[model samples]
Target: MTGTILTEDAGDGVRIVTLNRPHRLNAIVPELLDDLNHALEAADRDPAIRAIVLTGAGRAFCSGDDLKDFGTQAADEPGTRAYIERIQDVTRNLVLGDTPIIGAIRGWAVGGGLEWVINCDFAIAAEGTRFFFPEIAWGVFVTGGVSELLPRLVGLQRARELIMLGERFDAAQAREWGLVYKVVPDATLRDEALNLARRIAALPVGPVRDLRRILARRDALAPAMAAETDATVRGFLDPATAARIGAFK
Candidate 1:
C-alpha cells in the first residue's frame, strides 16, 4: 500500500524506493514522510532484503518541504509539530535502520531533502546535483540529527557555515566535503547507485549488518534525534519563524 513512494525489488536482497511526487519535486509532506517511514522499516525487516536504494522520481531528488503546504501547516502549531515528528521518524530509520540505505541524488536537494542525503549511509550524487541547508534562511531550525551529523561529516566549522549561510553547493563540493561517497555523470546516476547497492547486498548479510552497526554512533544518534525534534517543534511554532514561513507563501 505505497502512497507517495514506489517500491520495487531489485532482487539479490536489494530494494529500490522511489519518491513518487514528481510534480511537486517529491517535496516533504506528512503522507510522503509516513510512506517513507513505513517503506524503509519494512525493507529493513524483510530478511531477504539486505540493502535499500532511495531515489526521487523526477527532476529533483526533493525540493525540501512543500512550502505551499507549510504556510498553512505552521498556522496550526500542533499540526506543524506532528509533521516534523513524522519527518524525524524517517530520519530515525535512516540513522538506525538495519538495512544499508543508499541515496541516489540528482537535481535539487534542499532543506529537509538535503538532510535525507546527509543521513543516508552512502550517498551517490549526479555531477549536476545541488544541495543546500535553508533552515537558517527560512527562520527555522535544523532537524534529522543535522546539527550533529553535519559536523561529523564535514567538520564543525564547515557545517556551521553551510547551515548558517544556507547557500547552494554542487556535487563535487559535497564529495570533497565527505557528505557524498561518490559522484557520477547525470546519465548514469541510477545505474551506478544500483550497482553499488547490489554489490553491497551481495556481501554476507550478518557481517554487513554487523559492520554497519559497529560503525554507527549508536550512542549519539538518539540524543541528536531528540534534540532535533525539540528544536524543530520550537522553530515551527516561533512567531517570527511562522511569520517568515507565511511571508514566503
Candidate 2:
C-alpha cells in the first residue's frame, strides 16, 4: 500500500507500515490518519500478515499531531468530527486487532507520537531516542488513548510525572519504566524491531491474539480508566490549547 501519509508492504507474513512524512516528523494529520486506518485494516484482513511493524522515516518516529493543521478550518469544519472519529477508530483497531504491532522508534516520540507507540503491542527504541507526552503543555489532553495506555506501561506515579510535567525520557529510562521492550543502538533500531516482529510472526496466531485480548481486558479496568479520566480533565486546561481552540472557532 502507498499513500501520502504512509507506505506498506507484506513479507514473511509480517506487514511493515512506514510513516512517510519525514519533513514533519510523521506528524498526525487528517490525511495521514485516513491512510493509516486504511493500511491497518488491510493488514488485519490479510491472513498472511500475522504481525505488523510501524515506524517512521527520517530521524523522528513521530513528533505528534501537526499543530498547524490541528485547529485549522479544514480540521474544524462541520464534517471534521468524522476525521476525529476515524482517528479513534484506527487506534481502537490497532489495539483490538489480532495482528501484533511493534513500534520501531528512533529520535523523538512526543504527545500523540508517544500515544502511537503506547498503542502498539510492543515497542523498541533507538539508544538515543526520547519519549514524552507534552499534551498538557500544549493545552490539550491526549486524544490517542495514552491516558488508558501509559499507566499500564509505566505505572501510575511515573505516568503522572511524564504526562503532567511533560518530561522527556531517554531510551534507557523508558526501558526501566517498562515502556519499551528493548533499547538498541540507533543503527540497529530497525533491525531489532524487525527481528522482534519475525519472532511474533512465528508464533501461533490463535494463541498470540488470545494473549493480546487477555492483556487488554486486564489493563482496561482500573488504572487505565482512572488515567483516561484524569487526562481528559487536564487536556482542556493545557497552556498551549487556546490557540488551537481559537483557530477552530
Best by lDDT: 1
Record all residue pairs in model 1 with backbone atoms less than 3 Å apart, i.e. clashing.
Answer: none
lDDT at position 89, candidate 2:
65
Which pairs of residues clash in candidate 2, taking residues 3 or more apart in a chain or in different chains? 139-238, 139-241, 140-235, 141-235
C-alpha local distance difference test of each model: 0.87, 0.76
Q: For residues 143-170, what per-residue lDDT tens digits would candidate 2 score against the true structure?
A: 5666667777778898789988998889
**RMSD (Å) per prediction:** 1.4, 3.8
lDDT of 1 by residue, 81-200 (tens): 878888888887887788999999999999889999988989999999999988888778778888878988889889989999987899999999999999999899888888999999
* Weakest lDDT window of 10 consecutive positions for candidate 2: 71-80
Lowest summed lDDT window (length 10), candidate 1 = 70-79
